[model samples]
Target chain A: MAIKQRKLELGVLVASLALVTSCKREDRPFQTSAPSAEAIQFTRMTDFRAGGPSISGNQPSPAMSADETPEEKEFEENAYMVGEGKRLFSAFNCVGCHAHGGGGMGPALIDDQWIYGHEPAQIFCTIIEGRPNGMPSFGGKIPSFQVWQLASYVRSLGGLVPGDAAPGRDDDMHGGPPENSAPNQKPNDSSLPKSAEMPK
Target chain B: MIAAATARWATLADNDFGVTSGEWVRGTKSVLDPAGPQSGRIHQLFLDYFWLSVVVYVLVVLFVIFAVILRRRRARWTGPILAEPAPSREKLRGWLVGLATLATTIALFFLLAGDHAAGRAIRSLSTDNALKIRVTGHQWWWEFRFEDEAPSKIFTTANEIHIPVGRTIEVELHSPDVIHSFWVPNLHGKRDMIPGHPTRIAFRADKASEYWGQCAEFCGYEHAKMRFRVVAEPEEKFNAWKAAQLQSSVQPATDSQKKGQYVFLHTTCVMCHTIQGTTAGAMMGPDLTHLASRKTIAAGSLPNKRGHLAGWISNPQTIKPGVRMPANSLPPDQLQALLDYLEILK
Candidate 1:
């Protein structure tokens, strides 16, 4: 009986060892200081048009800032960063080209039919190394963290981000309309684009 | 005369508080209260038209009230008391029509006269041998070039225009992009800077003062912040400033400054900016040859102080949202070096 108990314990150990060895290595953003010079695994622009037209995740590490909270810790899940992105968007005059997501001189961002891929990493690549047709490259100008923040904020605009991370009101401007406001869920997921309703 | 005006305007424009509150300073673009001779005429003509319109409006309202009351009384007694009527009704109708015609003619005369006077005052104020300065409107800034017969005498500057007091400074305005209007309320009324259409605005300031001018038309994102200052100083000071601006890019003396200069030339800055005597001769952005001398950087968005300059270079979009100046992220030490290099530009 004692021998059988020893054999059972040995079997359990071998099974647990196999399970540990087979554990998947997760990709995350690396934690770094502000104005982080670390290279991000940005998606290539050519691949943006291929396949799903969405970005594929590489081996990314979670870049954590010192001054982050549980609620606003992960940049992907942080609502405050989205707010910061909104501010940067206006301040940088992204509205000048993009026209508040409706696209004027630049293409519309708040749509499903993305000319570029529909991934946060892909958008980050697009911003850093701008696409052709007058998309100015912002790689050298913008810091990596802020660029990431802007990318996350942009994703929120398209309703691809988690609803909780998306802000419902602007920091100022008194809780603007739907265009400025992001709802908990996409208001037009199934509906056709409002562009069709507009006079050509 | 220029010296006295310089002191007067300097006293009025030098505000201890800051730029926003500096509007109280007389040289601001206030259309109603003009400080220059040209704007004064425009203001006076505007007031004449304004008062006449007010008087006409009041009289018209009074007459309408009188007619309403008379009509009500006439209608009440329409049965017999008033129906057979006041004899000479035909004559009364003719008299009423004549009076209306006379009132209409008088109103039309004043309207036409005010329009004619305003147009003539602006047009006929041309002076010979005037100081020539060409103001080219960019997407977000004013490029001032002092024009002279000698090609070498032409020097370009941004955001600030220094004119000699008591002299007719004839400014030729043009735009490379969309429409922009140059209006310094204290100096002259708004004039559109349409692309391919050059417009001229000549103004002579009676007193020297720092006057604020802004792009009246909405060009783009940085339109509101596209401001320029007219420094109406003494003739000697104006000439000296203009002369000094002609000097080529002076080399940096300090090691830190030299490094900054090297970094600027080697980086994306040279792609858009031009610094005289340097390889950075691109004209897409402002000329930074005399950048340190300007009162405000980023086209009058912020003071040209060290901290503001460093902050702007670090991330300009943070300060002037939507401004074309890109966010060129640099290491802290390199940024400081660039600031140090720029500070000695004067």
Candidate 2:
């Protein structure tokens, strides 16, 4: 009976250890781990040009790929990063022109039409180098990591990122439905002028 | 001890106690200094209540002593056997109780009437020709927007409020995030600024002095740091301040100041703040058009000095944790240039 009792105790201890080890642990609630600047490479994933061919239908453009880098995965899938990016969107006054993605001074970010390519790299370039006319360059202003986060949030607004990673109802006045409910949109080829300049 | 307390109360009613010392003795000055007409009426009622309470306390203490002495005398004269009181003594005791009850009733009735009158008087303060100001409470700050009939005269400021002495100022309160109480104890009482529900209060400062105000309600993390100053100055001075606030930002005259302006426009500051005559015109944060004119920063958490401003820019969370403004890690040269540029904003 003593041997059987000892075995039961050892089994219980092993089960508790397994349970504790199985649960993921983070040092802090929000992931502040900075993404490497060089981790984003979209050349193979997207056939992006200054004025790329436009396609019709609900299908993703032929240039799109299924593979995603680890950095891109964290940016697009991590709930904390996406939530922080949503806050940055308002803090950086993106909502001033974008007006919660419906767009006022800037184009509607949630729509399928892409004046520039809708790939993650394309969006990053747009924010960093800026487009012509109304878009002001923020290359040297905002930190590169924050620009990446903002780009990830913009993708989520278009329902490009997974729904679970998107933000819920905000405390501010409602401009549209919660971002988690954003309808899925397929990225389209660019409609920019052929001679339109592109960021290096 | 009672006399000493009353003397202290008298000093508080004078309004000169903290003015000369330049130190705000929070509760005493805030409650007793009646700088405005509305607060003066309230203060008078409060004094009446204080005197009545003092009188009641003295009378009650004297009655207790008399009863104790009478009991001792009866114990000495009467034998060890305790007998019931005579009919005459019982009648006298009944009369004393009835007199005490009547006195208490009369005193309470007087106070009730005075309170009703004071409330009516506070509400009856004139709104005609009163300057209209809209106050919006944020998570840990206050925004004041002045309205005028002319479009050019309208301007917005934060933290500090400037008013002309002897002129009634009507303030409408709003809160975008949470419930916050607006209170300037010397000038007026507390009013809650609730989200979606706006409130209004009016008062006229008869004295030209600085009165401190703070958010009385318990708000988020930095609620204690949320304070403001109300400066009641001459009309001409107030007009001049308003005119300066309405003008566009001053042009950078020096190279450092110029660099500072460029940095401000290019950096994350422009994303939240607005400065007139500049390309940086977003409204997520306070308007810093006349920042240098204000006496304090961070909703009066720190005095508006060069070192404090630098520290605040370097790390706001150190001074006020959970503040929405993030820390900017700028190099030494940029930080100094920014300070120089901000200093001339007055």
RMSD of each: 17.9, 8.6
- TM-scores, all models, native as reference: 0.59, 0.73
Report the Cα lDDT for residue B329, model 2.
79
Candidate 1 lDDT over B26-128, as tens digits, reads: 3355666677777888888888878878987998899899999888887788643444555798689889989989988997898788778777887776678
lDDT accuracy of residue B173 in candidate 1 = 91
Give the CA lDDT, 0 to 100, for residue B57 in model 1: 92
User: Candidate 2, residue A115: CA error in Å?
Assistant: 10
**Residue B221 C-alpha lDDT in model 1:** 74
DockQ metric, candidate 2: 0.27
Query: Cα lDDT of model 1 overall?
Result: 0.72
TM-score of 2: 0.73
Best by TM-score: 2
lDDT per residue as tens, model 2, A1-200: 99999999999999999887534221122214455443323322343422333232222334324244356566677666677678788877788888888889988888777786666666776776567667766655676557767878898888888776788778778676788888887876667543574865
Per-model CA lDDT versus the true structure: 0.72, 0.78
Cα deviation of B339 in candidate 2 (Å)?
A: 1.3
Native contacts, share recovered per candidate: 0.04, 0.43
Clashing pairs in 2: none
Q: Which one is best on DockQ?
A: 2
